[model samples]
Target chain A: MKKLINDVDAILGESLAGFARAHGDLVSLSQAPLFVRRRAVTPAGQVALISGGGSGHEPLHAGFVGRGMLHAACPGQVFTSPTPDQMLAAAEAVDSGAGVLFIVKNYEGDVMNFEMAAEMAPCATARVLTNDDVAVENSSYTTGRRGVAGTVVVEKMLGAAAETGMDLATLQALGERVNGATRSMGCALTSCTVPAAGGPTFEIGEAEMEMGVGIHGEPGRRRVALASASAIVEEMMGAILADLGAAKGEDVLLLVNGFGATPLMELYLVYDEAARRVEAAGLTVARSLVGNWCTSLDMAGCSLTVTRLDAETTGLWDAPVHTPALRWGC
Target chain B: MSNTLVLRLIEGMAGTIESHADQLTRLDQAIGDGDHGINMARGFKELAAQKAAIAALPLGEALKKAGMTLVMKVGGASGPLYGTLFIDMGKATPEAAPTLADLSVMLDAGIRGVKARGKAEVGMKTMLDVLCPVADTLRSLVDQNETDGLDERIIAAAGHALHRTTDMVAKRGRASFLGERSKGHLDPGACSSALLIGAVVGVLAPSSAR
Candidate 1:
């Protein structure tokens, strides 16, 4: 229940205002219908990339809005999807005649709202749906896998491709290709509280953990007795590798992402274990990232993502990029 | 019906959602993320604030305005799904007072819009679980020319439909992530839908029935 905020209603606006001010040089904020756009819009011939979801997963959609990444980001209420109008406004602001591409997570609300935005958009539009979370079983009887930390990978690689003046269709295709090669799984040591809800989304005992948890604190595979970091990484990596069907000598990018409350010390420990596991499984770790790139709100946990990589994708991953939350070789 | 009735329905639904917000959040906490109540309440409160302005318009326009409010304010799966319901209903309804048959048509249109938007259907442990049955009851009542106690029948049908969600496995939304765990709990979206229907019908029903 304790949070550093003026009011529950003002949380998103106030936080966004601070973000816009702190990164004013890199991005601009629009409040009438809230969205963040790059201060420097993509060149007229380059396709614009937009992605969004509920708030509380800070430094995500919004932080990624800058050069060589998302052209804009539409943030919603805490853990709630942004409205279609936000998406449309972002599209209008950032679309440079090369059309717009929506990088959507595979959540129900995110999917539906983005779909509506696409249908109502004025310019040519396409979508790249990321469902890289291997925690849930994908079936006609379910909503399929969620898009979690692996979304960062899709956005970064596609952002580079877009920067290279890739056509809308090719960027969209590359997005899908990258997403299909990524797999992620997470376990939560505790639950997160949505500000308006005024309480934790779920309760976990001190000695227990929720395996395969989603970014929103949605129930994962199951609750089980807490285990060591090595054991946890093994279980999560097993699910991810089995689902990804990664083969020997294949190059991969390993990401160890922390939930909001998790510290870097622990995240790096996870990276250490995850990296060793990948090497033991005969996959070459060509690139690596470790941080809180995507997160649940102050939840104590982390997720591991492995992206099967090739020459083209690796080159894109290495491309110079500058964003508030992610920057390399810029 | 009349613009007055539309205003009353909006106000009543908003009040009901506010009162039941805690219950809805608790239900969602069990199988989904625990924000359904807060999200629905925020949207309805905004709609209620504009009820007068919205109700000043013609019947169809009023409903459409109300639906747009939900779409803009409520930022979850429910917002667009429920917004589509009201918007499509508004699209189908005429400016003139709608007959029972006309109401049935409007409900069906709304239901179809929800189905298409969510890519969902009845028996999926969603709001459609309650909404579809209520739509069917309205259609049947229109066919039978049974106007007496119409609101009572609709409320009863919605209650029954909402109850059925407790045993039905979810196939959409965050609840679907739970798989089998999603069963054995009421769908929060269905609960809110039934509550709104009850509140609206309770006020809109003829005074004589009460």
Candidate 2:
């Protein structure tokens, strides 16, 4: 609550404004909030790439809105999907002559809103929802589980394709390809606070932890009164590995993301264990990225995303991409 | 009945939730992931901002917006349920100015929406169990001119329902995961929601009583 703000009520709006202000060098958009873009957007020719969702998952949907990434990202309220109206605005703002490719993560609202946006987008919409990303289950309480950590990778890969002048149709297929290849599962040790609440979003006892936790802290698949760091990583990795049907000699890219509150030490520890397990499974770790790449506001947890790499994921991974969160070889 | 009264009711509820969220979270910690207090407070804070959205909107629309806002602004299980309830409430009243009786109707609609979405029911130790009785009793009392303006009786009823929650076994929700261990702790959903109702009632009471 006290970190940085003039008004708690205006935090989301203000943050959006601030994001546009600070990152103006790399990103820009129309007067409307939904209209978003990379600074050097081509208003003609290339198929525009667009992605958006709730605001809290920073560097996602927005921070990824620069070169080789999203053409526009409609930032919604935290953990909520952008409205159809916003999506339409973003679609219009970022539409290049060819069309627009929407890289949607598979959360209920995201799916529904994107569907509406596609029906209404100025450019013909090419939609790809990240269902293969999360290894969680839908619950009676939730419309569906959620699209979590893997979205970052999906957007990155697809955005790179769009930048390479891939047609909207091809970009959409590539986006699907990325989603299909990625498998992720998260675990939470503690909860993070919503800035307005000034308290934790959820609580986990000193000894308890939730497994397969959704990005929004949706009641995870299960919980255990915590175990060693290795054990936690083992469980999460096992889920991702099994979901991918990853077998011996498979090559994969590993991403170990901290859930905000966790420090680098723990993130690396989890990554270390993940590496060991992947190697033990006879899988080759092509590349690895670890740290708080995606977060839930200081929620003391981590997630593991294993992309069973094929030629496409590897090519996109090596693409000259520059986003706020992932910048290298550009 | 008046906007000022309604504002005060909201204020009271906000205060109680702000002050006592930890208690609710503690309850959740036992059976759930411990977000009851945090989720409700976040939902209400967003609720406060929607006064503008709700101002010209019909009661049902206002309720729906509040619910949708909760779902969008808040995360976790309660977010969508509470968010959907308000949305359904708004859909129910559409263009009508909901009276106190309509408020009961709204709550009933909300309960139904939550149940339909969550598959939760009374005595399952979810919010619906406590809310069902409260909303029904309030509507029944509307004819009796008994339940209005956040009175002590309503507060007591909510509290009674909340306390009674401890006696019921959790048939669903995260608490069900705990099985027998869930009996002793309060139903986090009911407790926090009652605190909301009770807080409003506290505000509506006579200043002299305070």
Candidate 3:
């Protein structure tokens, strides 16, 4: 309720405008049907990578929209999915002669809106649905596992491949493979408030934490008393490792992503714990990323994602890339 | 129905949604992301603003335009789902006045569109829970040649359907993430859908009918 904003209705536009201005060198904003496209034109034959979701997750789809990442990102209202018009327009704006690929999280709203845009897109388009959260039970009776922080991993690897002029189909296939190999789980110490809602999405006791929390502050698997950081990481890593089933000695990429309010100090501490767990399991932690790359508004939490990597994927992970939130070997 | 009647129905639905926005948010807070009320109120407010323009069009066109407005402005699972409902219903409606049978067909189409858009079914603890029952009630009424107290019957059916959602577990949307925790709460989408249906029918019926 006590957010620093002029008006609730203008929060998204004003923040987007500021972001566009601050990062004008890397991105440009379109007003009518809102979307952020890379400042530089997409290569003549390179596939365009577009991904988006609700707005509260800072520097996610938008901050990732630069060189060697997403070509464009369509942002919706806080915790709300973007409409189809935004996606379609973004596709038309960025799509080169090559087709477009949509990196969609497996939320109902995100999936439905992106599906509508894909159907209405003028050019060939495909989607990579990320459902890497291992907390939820995947079944025909449910919507399957919710896509959490692993989306960044999928986007980064696919962006690298697309930058190398991979065709749309190849990029889509690579994205699916990366997503399949990834698993994530999160725990929240506190709930974040959506601007429009004017209060926390869910209330938690002072000493309680929601295990397996989604990015949007949805209730997780269960709420339990707070425990030590190492204990939390043990349980989270256990779920992720059990789901991934990576072989011993396999090189794995570990991403300890902050859910907005958690600082880098704590994130690094989490990364340390997570990496130790992975190593203890007899897996090699070849690549590691720790930051607030994918966040839920201001929720105090973090998610750990483990991706089983091969030589090809490891090479892609090290590829040159420059974006607002991520930069390496540029 | 005439354009004026359609406009009245829009106003009624918008008014009802705005008034109950807080309740919807409360319901969602229990099992979902707690934005349903805010999202629904914003969409209907926009729809109300365009009532004059939308009312100028024929019934089918007006419904389609209204649906598109909701889709563009709502920006959540509810937006596309509700938008599909109205859009498909509009597609099934004739330009001229639709009879009871035609209305039944329109409702059925709208329900089908919602199902396809959300990949959901009647028992998924979504708007479909309320909408499907209302559609069946309308169909049965048409088949039985019952016209008296039609609005009351439809409203009662929707109310019952909405209440039924309280015990159901969510299998779709953000609420599904809660698993068994999602039970014992009314689905916000179903609550809003029932409210709109009741509002629209309330406007069409005379006071004596109630």
Candidate 4:
């Protein structure tokens, strides 16, 4: 219940105002606070990349808005999906005539609203859905696999592809290819507290951990007695690699994502174990991201994502990207 | 039956929902993300803000305006679901005074709209659990040519349906993630749906007494 805030009601507005102020050079907030887009105008023939969902997952759709990344992100309230109107507005604002590409998560609300928006938008729009969580299928908020940290992979690959002058269909195919190659699994040491709820979502005993937890704290496999850090990482990574059908000599991009409250030291430990485990499996770790790129408020946990990469995807991953949370070769 | 009466009825419904916001939020916190109350309150507040303009329109137009406002202002699953109900009801309604049969048709349209938008069916532990029963009762009464205490009958049907949802497991929305854990808690959407029907009764009972 106790945290830094002016008021519960002002959370979205104030947070966005702060975000816009901090990254004015790279991004601009629309008047509605529904979306944030790149500050500069998009080229007339370039495909626009747009992605969004609920607001609790910080540094996601919004923070990824910058050069060589998303052109717009439509954020809803905490754990809620943005309405179609927001998407329509963002599509109008950022579309440069080539077309708009929507990178959506598989949550029911997100899918419903985005589907409605696509029908309402003025410009031609194509969509790519991220359903990379290897944990539970048909969980509380979605019909298929929950989209987790692999969304960052989808956004990055498609963002780079769009910037490279790829047409809408080509970018969508690339996005699907990356998503098909990616798998992620998450585990939580403790539940997160949603601000509006004013309490932790669930209580875990000191000796228990929630394996395969969804990003929104939806129930996972089952609560089991906590294990050593290395042991947990191995099990999570094993699930992902098995699901992804990864094999020896395969090159992969690794992502060790914090579920908000996890420390860098722990994430690095997770990364060490994850990278070592995959290497032990004879897979080469070519690119890695270890941080809170996708979060669930202040939950205490982390997830592992492995994307089996082709040469083209690796090149796109290495492309220049400048955003508030990420910067490379700008 | 007047357009002014319809406007007052909508205003009354907004007031009822606003008063119960905290109760709905509490119910949601037990099994789902706890923002149903805040989202619904914000949406109704938006409708209240434009009350003067809504009142100036005919009944069907006013309802449509209210529905659009909720869709724009409320950012969640409930927003689109509830907004679709009102919008569909408006589409089925006539601009002038409507009879009991006409009300039944409007309710049927609204309930169907919710079903299409949410892709939820009966027994899914959603607002449909409350609204479908009420709409069915109204339709049956109209078909049987029974008009006595029709408003009270619809209200009772909605109340019964709302209470029944606590015994069922959620098969849709955030609470569905809880699986069996979602049982024993009242569905927040169902509760709000009952309140909407109660709001209608509030407007009709007093007018009938006069």
Best by DockQ: 1
Model 1 chain A weakest lDDT span, ten residues long = A194-203
Off by over 4 Å in 3: A1-3, B208-210
Cα deviation of A288, candidate 4, in Å = 1.6
lDDT of 3: 0.91
List lDDT for all candidates, in order: 0.91, 0.72, 0.91, 0.87
TM-scores for all candidates: the values are: 0.95, 0.64, 0.95, 0.94
- Per-residue lDDT tens digits of candidate 4, residues B1-210? 665776678788889889999999889878777878888899888888888888788777877888888877776788788888988998998866888889899989988998888888999889999999998999999999998888778778988999999998888887876778899998999999998788878788764321
Better of 3 and 4 by lDDT: 3
> For candidate 4, what is the lDDT?
0.87
The regions of model 4 sitting more than 4 angstroms off are A139-142, B207-210
lDDT of 3 by residue, B1-210 (tens): 877898898899999999999999889878887778988999999999999999998898888999989988888888888898999999999867999999999999998999999989989899999999999999999999998878889989999999999989899987786677788999999999999888878787845223
Q: Residue A247 of model 2: what lDDT? A: 73
For each of the candidates, give the backbone clash count: 0, 8, 0, 0
lDDT of 3 at B6: 82
Q: For residues B107-189, what per-residue lDDT tens digits would candidate 1 score against the true structure?
A: 99999999999989889999999999999999998899998888888988998999999999889988887667788999999
Q: Give the per-residue lDDT digits (tens) of candidate 3, residues A1-330.
A: 788999988999999999999999999999879999999998799999999998888888899998888999999988789999999999999999798999998888899889878877998999999999998889998888888888999988999999999998889899999999999999999999888767887789999999998898877788999999999999999999998999998999999999999999999999999999999999999999999988999999899999999998998899988988889998
How good is the docking of model 1, as DockQ? 0.77
Which lDDT value does model 3 have at B208?
Answer: 23
